[model samples]
Target: MVDAVARLLRRGLPVTLAAVDPVLLELRGVLARAVDPGDEASRIAALDGTLRGLLARFPDARYAAAARALFGLPPATPGMNLTARRALAAERAGHEVHHFRKRVEPRLIATLTAELLADADRFTHAPLIAPRLAPVSARQPVLADPFAWEVAEQEEQLSLLWSAIYAARAELLAVERLISLRAERTDIVRAAVTAAWRWAGARAEAISYTTAFAPDLTIDELVALAGWTPPLTPGQTSRLTEAAAGGVAREQFVAHLHGETVLDDTWTTGLLAALQSTEPTSPEQPGAGGSSTAVPADPDQNG
Candidate 1:
């Protein structure tokens, strides 16, 4: 199934990403189950989203680059013939096309197949959360049904939590960029950036860290621990160095972590809105609700 889809994508898009195509005929069952039974546009969006999500989400950087290039996905240039795609993949990943064909290609197909099947299975279990979490806020409330007012209150809290997490992540990526630009400079300026990185990372990775390592720990416990720990003062590089050096090396580590973090754990509107579009902003990124720090009105818009 995945192989057929990849071949279709390689042939290229508008055709590949079109609302309807003879190419999707063989994959109809799985695609139907994986997405909400809807018009052509919504299904296509879900399909494209799933493909990009899976491709961008490799724990291995080389594998991700190769897979994205091979599939004509983002972070990879979108249009290329088979030969050109293979060459681009080789260049980006530093792995020869022969090795990619022998090793990476097969693995990527297998992973894609598994994820697609899992999505189908998840749809089979859709009564669990899918409808409740649908992106329907533009019409009616997504959380709880029209009748469930009591449950709506709890869902509102979840929405607020989702908004907070989204804001923190946008800020965290901002800090990540700042630290990256000054990575070569080990000055007090770097120290300030690092401080912001730590603070932002703490919030952005909170769900991951807590879910993975410390589910039993409480917010108060974390606050007490923070109070007891030494201050992250100027000239302090130890924290950053340890974080960067301990695992997958700096660049790959950040790439992998950031990839994993671009998710909506709360299944709210904020994340989908952020993902739909991005605009160039000079001062800083926009936060949840499309608010930005010191952002000016669009020059194209009237007051």
Candidate 2:
């Protein structure tokens, strides 16, 4: 499902992410029932049934969109096996769960939706989630009213489908939260980057620090001046670092060391070098100097 969605995004399809919210909310409810400690046998039976129904619906829900996008046709016949369907749903759900507290990329949700829609043809040819191979003659004798029985069966399947969705609700919500945070983080970074660029533009040579009575600022300190946390990726960190380091000469990267204490120039140099390096600096690097002082920024400055 993840791969499919990525492919769709790459294809530039305008898939909607709103379709997933309801699916996730339903999954969360399913999980809630499982977490409850009552009626063990009934719970197991219901869970099994619900999962089976969802295994069908999961692919059906996305197939229409995928088929429409890929072939300009309606949804094709379902063909994926039950196990494959379940695996796809669970795997995608688990990914969102993993990113619950982390910053997710803003484009990820849309990309996932597109990929799922793109795989309509494959899913159409897949086996049923709950295939029926029982003898048709023997099964016919059990029902009093075939039409009523079929209607009831359909209702039950619908119920089970919803149950399956509720089961993974928590994970879906987590993914949603992560995606939201990612957008927020992007905005924050944009503002910070703009500020850094402006600061560098106005400065001549390098931005001096008030280390006269204070200590030298470290790379980590510079990051802090940007006003964010460790949620940033290596690429983002590097971009921020580059923005802050702009216009400053390598020799004057850590300028203005004026404390009574002896400043370790190597520590400052190493940190600046790491920040300026083309490759990302390792987290274990000495750039986050433990004894490094803070670089005071202007009252109105963003960096």
Candidate 3:
């Protein structure tokens, strides 16, 4: 039976290899740990130390050279970062789940059913002649025991069949879930991309405003470039649109539209006073013309 299973797997080697390899490696590690935890730890530590030494010795080695330097070592590819490793592990797990559901589990069920059927056949066709009967009075008797055995075998086979069916159903459900998770993961990546683009654009806009520089394109152009369309009504546009027919300046617009001040006037006044005290102000300054005189700089600089 094991040989038959081996042949079956060999025929489907390409399909099964990826699904089985990780599982086998993990199982081997577990068994090794169980057999000698200290030995396993030492082995791992030695391998890690060897790889580190090789990396230090050949910091610039590429491909084949790198592989040769770290020969007999486990994977050390930096590209397989923790997150990538986790994703790969999840993919492997899903594949293994699929393989077990499709191949291994079905074989086990079939084997059990076949064995039960053979047992039932043997029980139902057993010889029932009595050895103690005299030659002339010999009687061929029915085998009640065989019938009982056949009934037991039938029940066992039914149970096995149900178990196999249940297992297949479970595997199907799990595969469906795995597919759904993959789709969800894709959606998450897309959402993250969109958010990143929006953040970058907003940051760029803020920097442009702070620098008092006109952007290469207008806000409307930016919106168009970003593939967005305004959904605001006329009233909403009046409230937010700086150049709308009934729009006010940004500060006043925010205050009136939101029914609250855009900023704390007290805080603004205090900050402006602080800034004024730190620097000399000209009497001809527009907003500062009626304000208090600023401090004068050192006379040494007037030379």
Candidate 4:
């Protein structure tokens, strides 16, 4: 009987009518039997199995819609099974005896509805489903109800909408992270550039101090004026000494002193040389002894 009903449903009978009619007839027949009380249990189990099989096979939007309609039927408190009776007896004296209507049946229906809806959406939108299956036009109408198909399509649309929302959110987060990284790099570069500039200026002044017989100069004063840290490593110190001795200009010397890692050594060296070579005062006497200090006009003004 279960197999017969399943075959009919697969052949596309209206599910509600097909399920209810046969089940009612079977129950009526079981009740009419006078000899065996246990016969009713077998009949009820068969009906229950049939209902479950139907739900399992047609877990889709159309089936769910049909099931939802079925749930609206007048509530019928069928005779309790032995298991239900035992469970009710085991309940504590003050506790309520849980019934199908109060505790389990409604929840079961709701769960079935939800599962059907979810499965319907999953099958409809699945990329693997539509392309591999025969086109609706070529297949017999027996398996292809447009109303059922539309519910599945709507589920697919919802899936696509959620995917789009998630994709957009992911893109926005990526863009935000990119912007933050760019800002951090920019700040680091700016600090590096400023440090390089000041180091170059100080080195130029240091070279002047060493070469000229001017007032004694402190390393602290040189660093403060130049706005840079002196190279601490021996390799860097050697490089600066070599460049200074090679007649590298004040700007170049300053850049070299600032350290190669912080600045572009070649460009900084070139800039320093340009500044030093174009000085208005002679290199032989930057400030002469006991005489009025001669101030060279601003290099920008001269330019």
Tens digit of lDDT per residue, candidate 4, span 83-105?
Answer: 34324322411234455335543
All-Cα superposition RMSD per candidate: 15.5, 24.8, 32.5, 34.3
Off-target runs (Cα >4 Å) in candidate 3 are 1-77, 81-221, 226-230, 243-251, 259-303
Best by lDDT: 1
Q: Please give each candidate's TM-score.
A: 0.42, 0.17, 0.17, 0.19
123 Cα displacement, candidate 3 (Å): 79
lDDT of 1 by residue, 1-303 (tens): 656566644554333444234344324433553445455555665566666665666546656777677777654565677678777777677778888777767777677667666656654543222122456556665455555774665555444434434443454454334444434212322233333334333433443434454476453233222112223322332333334332233233333334221111111112222322443433333333443222222222233
TM-score-best of 1 and 2: 1
Worst 10 residues of 1 by lDDT: 260-269
Q: In every candidate, how many clashes are there? A: 0, 25, 0, 4
- lDDT of the candidates, in the order given: 0.45, 0.33, 0.32, 0.37
Global CA lDDT of candidate 3, please? 0.32
- Total clashes for model 4: 4
Q: Cα miss at 189, model 4 (Å)? A: 1.7
Better of 2 and 3 by lDDT: 2
Ranking by lDDT: 1, 4, 2, 3
* Candidate 3 structure quality by residue, lDDT tens digits, 1-303: 323322322222121332222222222222232333335443343323332333333322232232221222124233343333333323433435345445533443244234423433433442211112125566554457987766665544434333333333343333334433444323322232222223223323333332343334243333222222223344433333332113233233223423221111221222233233544556632135663222221111221
